[model samples]
Target: MGGTNDAADGTYALRAVDPLIGELLAGLPALLLVGPRAVGKTTTAHRFARSELRLDYPPTAQAVAVDPDAVLRELDEPVLIDEWQVAPAVLGAVKRAVDQAPHPGRFLVTGSVRGDLDSPTWPGTGRLVRVNMYGLTVAELLGRAPREPFLDRVAAQGVEHLPTPLERPDLRGYVELALRSGFPEAALELPADLRERWLDSYLDQLLTRDLAMIGGQRDPDRVRRYLEALALHTAGVVEHQAVFRAADLSRATADAYDHLLRNLLVAEAVPAWHSSRLKRLVRTPKRYLIEPALVASVLRLDTNSILQDALLLGRLLDTFVMAQLRAELPLCRSRPRLFHLRQADGRREIDLIAELSGRRTVAIEVKAGAPGTGDARHLAWLRDELGDEFVGGVILHTGQLAYSLGDRLTAAPISTLWA
Candidate 1:
């Protein structure tokens, strides 16, 4: 994590944009990096290691185990082992290595899926630091342009001082991202249709291969239907009963499917933020698809229809804004906890709650068009309810301007949220 890892020299290096890099660089004696499929957990680990032993790859499992003393014995530094979850048994080996020589930044472990050990396993609690990695942020994708500094400027000058001018991503970029999805390699290499094919194949593999080993349900098709249903219901509060009806699944089956989605890191539920002693705050959490483009594609909601359709447009904007906030979380040295604010009278609702460090919070409303008083009505209500604890309220919309509605509200452009 400190010096550098030369093991990355010969590997295919995509632009290293993971904001978690700095945290992962400061590895404990043992650590685990977990994420959904194709989030670049393995490559990032290898790049951070001084040397690496890829246990999940061919031949190395035998090489590392049979000659553990030979493989890591002479090595006096951190060595990353990719996809370590595939061989959970080797964790005990790594644990013993740590016991013998407990050096910080010694073992960097990466895993895509989570599972249980058949036998009693070593608990490397304080010895390991856990981190989550995800797809490229818009900041990372913008390269070295003025757009690259959008969020940085907002952070420095405060939302009120943020510049109102910036060029936005055109329809082409939006279409490409929607069709291609966010698996780094597939996104970078393949054509749109081909990338869609790859995404479909990846989904199939997760369902047929990875999910089966989760050991609960024998049938994965049900899981597939539940996922599709969840995707369609993106950016809304989670209701298992509604999902049961939509997917034609039993209540128990729906619950199990939801658990599997979480276990697989395929979906996320954002809990409501109602710590107010006020008796009227809504406590039910909202659910969002982890990736915006995936939800758009699953719902076949490409193009400006997302801007024109009321319900679909709202969900799309909400999900995309959530993605932007998530991209900024690691950069701010915090975990992004998503939330929604609602009242019992159905009179007020804020779409996003960005909880930052020191309990400083920002309430954001997602909109499809220009920012207006109406767009920020709910945001203003939330600020009134939460008081000075509110960092500021923002209305994220499709417009190119970053104008302020008032002293407390800024209409932020979605493309510039992380510009």
Candidate 2:
């Protein structure tokens, strides 16, 4: 395993997913690590790779493009193919090689853009197991091992068992952390001005070069406007019409752009929770950029700007919490599904829900201020509705301590996520 100080050079970090990747590679013929650009996919792959074939290099790509099988045959075992999407035919060669041997740890492939989205027939249906990677979570940055999903733990063991955090960040501090982002360079190395410029360049490349490589042809300016609009609505149920008008995009173009962003793994949608036992529930998915830094960069927000606006701070906090939870999902033993809950009449809502096995759930609410009993009202209501299936509820706030609000519900500091 990589050491905890892996990010000293601002290129790699010991990710929570690293152990899982190692375990998977021992039995699987090929493993594909997929995430946004500059999220340390290549650096992680290098840890276990004995030899490498960088498909992004022109000569390597051209040679593989001509006869992928022959080129692949020449590499040593456990080869790393960086940016394998540059030569799509190499996937076919990999499929054939694995078919002949069916051995473990043959290849490690990394991709910034998903190649299957544009392929007519995916060559890696069974041969390659694709793992979802994300930016650095707080626990990862703190050099902690991968966390067992806190929500799942609460569901099984009650909220009274919540631990106290050693470090507490005030509201302004949390805002600054959100803006710092999870990208290794932006979060751990770059200064304020340089971080902003780095994030801006990332967006520019995504809008121009990355999109074109994925067969998307749209005006970069228009795409930027659309992205800014989404950033404004991050962590909320999107109002498509309002976003379209704000970006001056037609409905069709807006839909296409949305699909394009999701395909690139830059955005995500958390589906609404619904059940046959419940009626009049809202089903619209809540949308969020994969990381808070992307939203802050696109909207050009600073610490003072977010701190002064309560509504904006709340949304960004939700985004931040969601990112942490998503990063921990792979480490959970239960592997619970995540969702948001709302009523059609807007009478009750929950910021996030983790549905464990057997349909049981742990409901969560996010509050920007120090939490009080009033903050868990919606959680209480959901607890009453679901009874045993609703194991517990929690209100995550910027406070310094954890305490019970009511039966089966508690208010805990958001820092507990990393604790």
Candidate 3:
């Protein structure tokens, strides 16, 4: 992360070194990089391979679609196949090639969408090791390191090593950071108007092209409306019927749309943390957009509106924290799974939860304003209820200090996500 250039231009930010990528490339025959569009999958894959075939190009797509084997036969070198989803047959070719002649690092496949059931490729299973990615994290964008991965830290010890800071992100500072686009092509460096236009175009492409590719006689206009409605519901637990009604989509159609978004990693379903230890834990998972800026783009909310709208700000602050934890979880040593916890009656709730092996779980409560002792009440309750299974709890706020609230409960600033 110290270097200004990542393999070349400064546009490529130094994403945290993912040991999974290294290990997969060394032992696996194919590595599939899956995520939403413009997530830097192609850019990251380019770093390791000399030979490449861009299936996104019309000519290449046609070639692979027509005869995937010939395309693979032509690539004798370790090859990078960009937008492999465009020609699902290429996946089959890669699988066949791997089986015919076993070799590590023979193929690097990048996809903007999830695997197509109709694709000619077999499940690959042991053949294709998948690595999920997202838009550049705040740490990567700033070219800095996170102060401490609170998720892993809390999982290891119960608030024993909570970082202390005299200053952190205040209210205004939090909004400013969230407003910055996580997409590298149109990040904070760009003017506000330009970034907005870029985001608009990105949505246009998704609705116009990618959505249709998922099947069904999908109407882009309807899908656009559905996505807009979905944006309004982001960062909260939603009933499928409510979502379908808002989007004017049938239940079956909504299921297909949900699958597509989930495949793209655009809509993260934060599963509700269930524990037999508790009396009653909600089973509904909260819906979250991949990045906070996407919320602004979809809802057409400007910076001024975002700042003035308290309700929107609160939901987005929660979504942004989810984005950060999701990005960091894979990089953490514990590799915990992120979840949400709430009572059916809404008596208690934790905005974010990270669960590791052996019932060890770290709970987080996101507050857009300064957090006080009361903010830690839910965390304290969870700790007491779960006992040793509860790794610890934290109140992540827009405050300026990191301090302990009580036993196994601490208050830390949101900015600590990317120190």
Candidate 4:
């Protein structure tokens, strides 16, 4: 129930990005942690910050709004500027500070919304290095370092090298994990009913306060309906027309809502993978609600409900797998890019693909139940198509066993994500 890497104060959980933050601090003049609100960005930044300038505080925000440079100059080195977006002028101040000294670890800024939305020209373009922060991943919840990306390891060493999982969740267990919600307060601290309320409140705040902060003025009811529609199609190649029709939104309003959701970090798109070697591949990106918990919350789905709907269960599982993979991305040495692959004819499809260095790829398929050789047929075909460019293929499933499906292919339990 408690995080393994809780800070001395017992209020913070050491995250997978903690080491990356330290590594970046040693050289970067400024570091910006960007993510959804209440995702623990402020808590994480507090760990390294010596002096604090919380722009969320009204007086502080007013001072920064009036004269950002003066407010910035008064703060000590390695200052934390929480909710810098509240007073967007601080970006120019931070930029100026970095230009004058060019010192590492001088500023640590946190923002709930995307930084670029407030300004026509971003002042921190070169001075600040942005690092994405997401909700607590299962690895972080368990207090595991996840020092190396599991997928990257599979790409490099093949599936034979996968560690035997210490814990393998059954189908029901996996469903619970998906519903656990990665938000620290929801996943770690709250009861089920309270957690549901917390999630609902989180979405409410996002639609009202957060949307207004980003200059998005729209009907909350319409936005919520749109969000619910998107939730139904989570982890699938989105059909814009169908979604808009379901939400009763016109094209222009739907696009605006889409932009707002993305800027708020509530929705994400995993782009379709395309290669010159392959033809008739679908280029539509798969849309997700950023985390499985949000999808479950938006749909008002419980464990029993999800278990009853096979299609919904599979999509949620995919979303769950994606959340874990996105968390592990920062740790990957090769810095792979994630994409979903599908052919126009629907003859071939890969749930996820990690394109490693040199355009080589590691393909993955997510299955709700134990996967057999047939489940890996698509992966094997991709392997054969790409030859040496294909590092390996894996069928991640709810099965308890890890075994070989064929050459350069294996079926491993989904728990290996955090193992």
Which one is best on TM-score?
A: 4
Instruction: Find the number of clashing residue pairs for candidate 1.
Output: 2
lDDT of 4 by residue, 1-419 (tens): 12122445675666888888889998888998888777788788888888999887899999988999998887787899988888888888998989999989899999888836545578888888888888888888887763677867776687767765989999999989888888887887778888898888888887788888775567888999999999999998867888889899999889889888999898988999988888899989999988899998898889999999999999999999999898778778878999999999899999999998787799988998888888888999888889989888888899898888998898889999888
Tell how far residue 206 is off in model 2, in angstroms: 1.2
* Overall lDDT per candidate, in order of appearance: 0.65, 0.84, 0.76, 0.85
In terms of lDDT, which candidate is stronger, 1 or 3?
3
TM-score of each: 0.85, 0.95, 0.91, 0.96
Clashing pairs in 2: none
Cα displacement (angstroms), candidate 2, residue 222, comes to 0.2
Summarize candidate 1's per-residue lDDT along 1-419 as a digit string, tens digits: 01111123453433333435545555457777766778667666766678877666668777766656567666546777676665555676677787886766788777766665222454455555666666655544544311332333433355676565466654344434444455665655567666666666777777787787574555877877888788878888756678778988999888887877777777888887776454576776687778776776556556665656677666766776676566455445443465787777767777877666556667777766676777777777666767866667777666777888876778866766655
Q: Count the backbone clashes (under 3 Å) in each candidate.
A: 2, 0, 0, 0
Tens-digit lDDT string for candidate 3 (7-71) = 34445566654456666788877888776788677777877776999887899999898998888
Model 4 stretches astray by more than 4 angstroms: 1-11, 115-120
Clashing pairs for predicted structure model 1, backbone only: 1-25, 150-419
Flag the better candidate by lDDT, 2 or 4.
Answer: 4
Off by over 4 Å in 1: 1-27, 62-76, 116-122, 144-157, 170-179, 297-308, 334-336
By lDDT rank, best first, the candidates go 4, 2, 3, 1
